[model samples]
Target: MNTTEIFLIAILVIFSAPYLVWRLGRTDYWAPLVVVQILCGILLGPGVLGAFAPAVYDHVFAPPVIAALNGIAWWAVMLFVWVAGIELDLHQAWANRRETGITAGLALGIPLTFGALAAAFLLRWPGWSGPNARDWQAVLGIGMACAVTALPILILLMEKLAILREPLGQRILRYASADDIAIWGVLALILLDWDRIGRQLGFLIAFGVAAVLVRMMMRRLGKADRWYVGIIWLALCGFGADWSGLHYMVGAFLSGAILDAEWFELEAMDAFRSVILLVAMPVFFLSTGLKTSWEGGGPAVFAAAALLLLASVGGKLAGVHLAGRILKWPRRETHVIGWLLQTKALIMIIFANILLDKGIITSATFTALLLMAVASTMLTTPIVAPMLRRLGGA
Candidate 1:
């Protein structure tokens, strides 16, 4: 088949296979369509599908097709991250500073500690850390991965559970919002290139000045113009970040983070997010899958994934329980909240992708983190629902 035809075939499989399984199998309770799509990406990756049917995989995912898909995936994830940035409600977090601080701090801190220890253990062996990584870089990167909560996915899950408008949901959003800011700040720290420190510093200084001008212009524009200008702003920030060696997604997040979410209509913002997920994000998931490899062996990858899953879930639960005790939350509230906060999918995957791209983690390590994220997300709804039911509702 021609490049166009093959690209369409790839897209067909990407969108259709996961949707069929998610819809037909009725996995919404445990595995939402997004989670299912991520899993399907792994299954279709070179390690799995290519191992079993190399010819088919090669023919379908030819170089031209992969490149086309990657172009789409790049912009798709950029837009997704930008939306996530805009959705951050730090004002609400500031209003409830004490509660948000204690909850977000413990929830993030404990998991990071546990994950750092796990990364330490992995570093004792071969194939886990990347060639370019320092021991500290490897540990910190993986640690942050464990601590990340997918704020966007959390919103989706809460909406599905019908608690998105509830007080509890609002509280969760505040905590996640605070943590979201920390996650990117830490990412910038990790990506700090002393060799390119001059360039990176220049980028930050320039961005600060540009941000002032951009906010002023945004305030003066109509809503329609604001949306168009936002895209241009996003692209420029992405380019600047990438040029500075900090990576483009960080730039994408900052582009939206500096802007007020209220500038756009809430309904349109929500609809835009959903449309991006439904259409473009599947390609990002597929591209992510293409990068997966079991270079250290499948069994080793699975074992590492299991280990990280334990650290992530156990640490999150432990931290939340401590917070509950301190704040005197109700009996079952901590379990429900912890499970919900443990939901790591898009953001964690994005974090790992950055680490992999920067050569802080090897492909095997990325695969392990990928598996851990899928498992962590799948465990969220089933675990939280029963707890919410027993806790007098979400």
Candidate 2:
């Protein structure tokens, strides 16, 4: 529990966690790594192991340590956002895919309606002393939280399961990409000052122009050196966005999506992915886990937690189902896609952290939302995968 020991543990975790994941992938127990990673954190954190070993927990999760952890979390999110952008296939979805439009509408509409209703009730309820429950900001934040679709989790699952190339998978990715852009746009409008929108739009236009220039510049660079340059550029974009009052992940995502569209072949993309995923993302995930305090207050908290979970699950189902019907898709495909899209993870955490940082939601609410995310992810993935298999689809 001393300073020396703390440093060692930090080193061990940083160096070993990803190695463990890689090794586990070669064994029969590979699927459990995600659960194990979080569970290990819970045990070694304030929940159980820390309860029994307070000094160790204090030494490890100290204020300085927590601050460092938050840095890692932000970095991890940026990596994930970068990967998200790289995965974008702009023209993949049929331009007239009724399924795309309908499914997306359902995804957004169901959550917005359900979230607003849920927030209205939560605001009126007792407990929740952390913030002014009735604040319009709280309602906006919660509504947006409920409306989130974890596009990264979807992409990861689709890729890991080797279904990324499937038609349904392509549809999900295409629809999800469009949906992600729109959702962020909606989030910006909800959160930004109305006067800033024009400036924000201007910055985006300029960023697009800059990206083209950067791509052309990169084309003249040596193949092995573009990655180093890309890192510098990524950091600059992140800095620019932060300075402009935009979130860091937005800059990272934009940089990524822009790169994806720049006619880079698989080799350049692969190199880019290696740096972002191998080095950056694990740090981000560990940081996110460390910042999050899963255990919260009393019975009222638990009730609120349950409601959040239900809203996340139920809202997605309602939205996807209605979208499918509108598009005249098969009932089973519609049902599968509904469940497939509900498992919120990476992007939800990124956006939720933004709300938490802005004081729009309390730490307790963020914790509850995290729990809702983990629960939905664990359940939805297994459930949807089997359904996809049954339908002889992805």
TM-score of each: 0.99, 0.83
Candidate 1 lDDT over residue span 317-389, tens digit each = 8888899999999858778889999999999999999999999999999999999999999999988887777
User: What does the lDDT come to for candidate 1?
Assistant: 0.94
Task: Specify the highest-TM-score model's number.
Answer: 1
**lDDT: worst 10-residue window of model 1:** 385-394
Question: Per model, how many backbone clashes are there?
Answer: 0, 1
Q: Model 1, 294: alpha-carbon shift in Å?
A: 1.1
Task: TM-score for candidate 1, please give it.
Answer: 0.99
lDDT, residue 208, candidate 1? 97
In model 2, which regions exceed 4 Å deviation?
Answer: 1-5, 13-32, 42-52, 125-134, 193-209, 215-226, 267-280, 293-296
Per-candidate Cα lDDT values, in order, are 0.94, 0.67
lDDT of 2 by residue, 69-99 (tens): 5676676667667667766676655574665
